[model samples]
Target: MRKLWLPLLVVVMVWMVAGNGEARLRPDFYGSACSNVEGIVRQAVRRKLNQTVVTIPATLRLFFHDCFVQGCDASVMIASARDDAEKDASDNLSLAGDGFDTVIKAKQAVEAQCPGVVSCADILAIAARDVVVLSGGPNFTVELGRRDGLISRAALVAGRLPGPDFDLDRLVSLFRLNNLTARDMIALSGAHTVGFSHCSRFASRLYSFNSTTAVDPSLNAAYARALMRACPRDVDPTIAVNMDLYTPITFDNVYYKNLLDGEGLFTSDEVLFTDRRSRPTVERFASDQAAFFRAFSAAMVRLGRLGVKTGGQGEIRRDCTALNS
Candidate 1:
């Protein structure tokens, strides 16, 4: 584990120094343009979460989905004429509506105060950070100045985003493409501590995973039985199960602990603990909340930097649900 940490740290440092000539994001991005950008996003997220706790996880997942597909731009919020946008992607259908609604509401609030100044992408980055803090997680500094993407085709989503069934190597390869290390991937996944997964996403484990496998042998028997009740063979696809049954509303290390106990809801998640390369980080995070929070914060900042748009590349979308005209 000690040997691994050095390599991971070097990778992160290299990423920090590398750039592609686009406008770089910074913590003080809106210092002069929209002094209250962070406050506006925080207030809107708090109000939405106050209305429904689900928005915390929803917003977090929303940010992840958006970044993974088309950088940190707000392309995921765009609605297409023929339902061909990123949001319409089959894998994205389960994203909680509350997440989109919260961003829209926050964008509206930002526009009211600093119309046409803050980008929807920046709003999402800030909102994601705020929601985590509001949910009892670490309050890390979030860089801003990301622009909204103009192109959001559903065709680009399939292979770009990691799925709920990926193995360790596949997951590592995916995150590495975005400049994230294996430790970063495990830490970022800790967000599952507060989210909900639809029955359809994990139903295979309860019924039949494949032609030869009836259930995932890694899952705890008692937990599997409970999941079966929550997600029967014929259960509606829309029905959801808390990702972390122990502390679904809190943003702690309980999700990692659950994985340690074979209570991970997704195969993608459990594979982290089972795979030797990532298992140490998973175990460390499960036992040390501070470590998880630190890594998660750093990884999120890295995620926010993935394929960002800036320096006249994109626009400050007036309406998050549609591209700027």
Candidate 2:
């Protein structure tokens, strides 16, 4: 792990230097130009949500995937000709199309009124917040002024996003690269409460965790059986299960409660309680839903500011899926 941090730290230092546009973002950035940008996005999001509940988690996950990459620039939504874009990466291949569709639809509505005044990046930020609110989560203001990124490559995604199996140390180090703290990582993990994960993402916990233990010892025996039933051996890789078995559709601190009961779907998810270091925070969140909401809301605002492109750094992409000609 010492060797891992040394080289990774160098890469992060460079990313920080190149991607620090948070100071340039402001909530009212489009107030003078597209004052109704948030309204337009929220309306589109509500409509989409009515069509399919999947929009809520899909858009939320999309926002995370976008920011964890080169920055929250909507590069993940870019369509590549040769399958080399960020979305084309294996880690991102499972991203539901509804996530991309939400942003594109919102971008279209914004463009109709504001023309080149609004950015796809800003629209995405607003849409992300809209999804959270629509899903019974805390509502928070989203800062705007992000410009669409000019770069989108699969190679840049390696080691950027957190994995399902990362231990506490690995998770902390990876999030720290973006200047986020351990507390922030826990708050973000609350997102799992609302989304779904493919069977392949956590099947290792059931099938072949190690030579000795057939299943992870930390997993509750009943929950492990439930997982195996949903994702039997040789099950279709595309088969997905809700992240939170109790209240999967609602966004809440039940994730922490689930962690406490050893029902967390991923090793990374369950470790919040299994590891003594992060257990207290998990306990606090599980016992106090209000505290979890406050932390999650604040963390999301901070998340939107990561590696944003502002002013001349990026263009107001006329289309969310392609760069301007």
Candidate 3:
């Protein structure tokens, strides 16, 4: 009886923490309070994205990182005085500054039109979609009424965000916890089509991935040579290279095509093609850009709903970087 009780108790705790009891989300959630919310966010995101092209992928990734850990509540944006908040987590350290800046700026813009009428959580969801559209990806509608989470813990990030080297099975297992499927995982990976990765994330593949000889045999020779030059043995860890070299600034199927040619920047990206269960999805996306866009847009909507807050579950934070005071 004791053994059975322990397992059941653990399951219940996990369910509760995952926000299984939160209010449902809807597209017209702010219809009465802020009818112009989406327009406000779209304008703000575009303005900031124009300042730096990197903002497109950064904002998209920011939404993923936030949704995975504790739902799309903007908990990732919370600041910790002790430096032990989600931002302190190593997995989150690579998140570009422009991503956070875009959210902050959007929040400020929304406030100007309808003070205290929008939640950072909803702003993040809408902004993420806008960034994807600006990058030439499909435009999808996001459900709103998400309230901001009050807790932000660094400890939760490690197990939440899939590592840069996660294999197919591992990626599937992690995303499943958030109601994401294998197809969703591959489609969402398409976001890599517009981002940049720091050398440190893939330096191992360029220099002694497994042995001391330097370079992974799975990588294409020409791509490896280029990577070596871009990321030298003693190069600064902060130095970055575009994830999609073929069309570095566009949101397209070239990323999957690169995988077919062995140009994937991270082991995690390459494995999608190597793993049988995921290979078909990768191939389909590579051969058809429209299909990839459709899948990606649908996946984004599903991801945006993970463990979301609605009604009075959370708050409408005045400052996006801090919880309500």
Candidate 4:
């Protein structure tokens, strides 16, 4: 009876946390306060997308980084004079300028119609989905009503994000700590379908990969050669490459197919297919675009719900780059 009681209590706690977040974040959360919220954001996002193709991956990556570090609160948007904000962190420094620009533009447009009624966090969430749809990916409703967090510290970002070299077990454990499962991790990884990674991030896999091999054996021979040409050791390591080689700019299920063909850019990505535990999911998503779309949408919703500060827990920052004074 004692053991059973503990398990039951844990289950109840998990259910309450998940249920409470969903209740607070609704699709029509701004229906009354800001009736044209989605439309305003869509226009702003479209404008940004038109100006630069980087908008698609940058904004999508921004949302992921924001949610992972600060629980979808847009705390990552804060800019500090002392260079100590979350965005100043090494993991976040690579986030492109276009992402910040997209959210800021949307926030400005939102404030024009409904001043102080919308949070930067919600705008970011909406903009993320908008970019995905604009980039030829799945269109899913984004839950709104998340408030911007006041705290943004560079010190808080370490180990919060998944790395390029993480193995399947490490990746699964990291996601699990955030109340996510292996399936969720794999599905979320599909975002790489339209993502980019810098050369330095995966240089080791291409050159000097231990004494056993020159290049990672998991990489397709032809793919490795392509990567080497694109990211020569003597050249700048900051040069960026698309995560999906086939559809470099589009957001689709090609990411999973790349994994099946050993073209996954990062070990963290290819591990999804190499590990027997997660290979089946990788294969399923690779073959069925509809299945991948459904799973991705569901995973994104779950990812957005992590550590959310809804209701009175957080504030609606007037300036996304700084907490309201």
Candidate 5:
């Protein structure tokens, strides 16, 4: 009986150790191949965004327009000229035009290297990072494993995405609806560090605007001047859009930095620095790029999961330029 007991103890210890070993190896076993493909896709998207003549800030705008409207379906990134008339009529300037071409080139290159494995969703994420880097922002790794969303709903564009005028509470709610936390909302809004906005979208804040909403007093002078120059007070209602004056192409803490300095270009953007609840997160991101990157990656992972109808739930349109016929 003593001999049998000793043998059982040894067998149990060996089994436990082996189980631990397999557990440790599981992530690598499951993730290594996908990681490599994701890396390749990231590099490919980066290369294309860098090489393209379109300004980095403009590209970032296109990316946001595409993703926020649909579930990063790459539909907004497609051109409709080859598709039917309904598709052509539905074409969005931000998506179906030059940006779509750029994504297509990148997607084609990635497909050649990795075949059917790499997802369009992953490509969009990589491309966005590339755009930020080109615009003069820090580079961060985006986690892979997002599958391409097949259906792109144009109508979802207006309500789903937050606009420039959204106050802190409204913005927080929008982010929450998408499964994002307050921290995520602040960090993700850091993307504004690189892009531009039309003055028309923000003119209300400068001219006769909401007084209850705090405007950065430090920014009032420069903001008013820039607005005057861009709008001319009485001429055309159209406002020529300009990229974020500083670090328009870079993805850095400069956005938060701008807010701290009262240089934020939009009312919604400046409010992050002033809001009591959100200010600390904004300052943290401003001071620590590493911290910002970590949070941003996490937030992006969450954002990618929002309203995503994956697998058979959606169809992969062969032509991203138009919805499925």
Candidate 6:
């Protein structure tokens, strides 16, 4: 009995020491430590970005629409209030254009307070959350420490970002290119639960057999009439617009429910339910708001990591609207 006890004790000691050595090999394993300057900078930047979003919800949505279309580049931020034609040409409305201005103002404030401490990418991320909140969605804290992009290529905008014409496959492919999974694709599209779109974007669905732009027949008749009124046939092709009339200011499972009922306004919105691969995720999100929020938050964290060049890889942009020119 004594000999057996000694061997067991020796084995326990070996196991304990080996476990400590393995833990040391892990890169993220650490003991309690003081938060660094980078941590403080991250917090400040997030706070400012969140505030900017609350102040300008429409702008945040526009910013997101522009960025997602083109590699998260900030070119869509460029606008001149005096030139309505120029603004419209770029698809920039007064509400969205002002939001861009607010982002710039917030960026300037952060520079004044932190001086090259926060990144444009981080600002965009936090601002997106604020947009969700203002639109009547859940507000969650975003992890920061992203650095600004030194370059903002306009050419990248047209081909990279998803548009009103894209189908489920195209949408999924774009998200995949950005490192987003199928789950992320469904969760992020839930954002549409709270915004509006131009009729020009979805008119093809109503008028043509183009599956990518076709409207669902199950939409509410009154809602359809309102959209048609706002976008009559004689209306200029560029002037037609449509709002996500239901839950336009709230973030919930209604978007998914709309899809379930064949009421999705955009083909992209409807494809989630139509596509074989994406259908399950859509149903899950539609059935559970809390689940949707959880997945959405996780996906956002992943999205914020896309193309992020941190530490020595990128510069902190003083102006979020323009490249470091």
Lowest lDDT 10-mer window, candidate 2?
A: 7-16
lDDT values for all models: 0.83, 0.85, 0.82, 0.85, 0.55, 0.55
Task: Give the top-scoring candidate (TM-score).
Answer: 2
Across residues 1-325, which tens digit of lDDT does each residue of candidate 4 receive? 0111111110000000122455689899988999999999999999999998788888988988888886888988999999999999988888888999999999999999899989998999899999999989899988988888888999989999999999999999888877788999999899899867788788899998889887999998878887887778875655667777667678889899889888888999999999999999999999999998999898888888877888888899998898998
- Residue range 82-161, candidate 2, lDDT tens digits: 99999998888888888898899988888899999998988888998888888889999888889999999999888888
TM-score of each: 0.92, 0.94, 0.92, 0.93, 0.73, 0.71
Report the lDDT tens digits of candidate 3 across residue range 225-269. Answer: 777777778877667778887676688898999898888889999
Which is better, 5 or 6, measured by TM-score?
A: 5
Instruction: Give the poorly placed runs of model 2, Cα more than 4 Å off.
Output: 1-18
lDDT of 2 at 269: 95
Roughly what TM-score does model 6 have, to 2 decimal places? Answer: 0.71
The lDDT, on a scale of 0 to 1, for candidate 4 is 0.85
Regions of candidate 4 where Cα sits further than 4 Å from its true position: 1-20
Q: Residue by residue across 52-84, what tens digits does model 1's lDDT show?
A: 887888888889999888688888999999999
Candidate 5 stretches greater than 4 Å from native: 1-47, 50-55, 62-70, 78-98, 114-117, 133-141, 145-147, 210-218, 234-243, 323-325
Q: Which wins on TM-score, candidate 4 or candidate 6?
A: 4
Give the per-residue lDDT of model 6 (tens digit) for 174-220.
87777787788889877777545555666665656456644446444
Specify the poorest-scoring 10-residue window by lDDT in model 4.
7-16
Indicate the worst ten consecutive residues by lDDT in candidate 5.
9-18
The global Cα lDDT (0 to 1) of model 6 is 0.55
lDDT of 5 by residue, 149-260 (tens): 5544445455656766678998888777665788988988887765455455566656656566433353646545655566555535433433345544556777787677
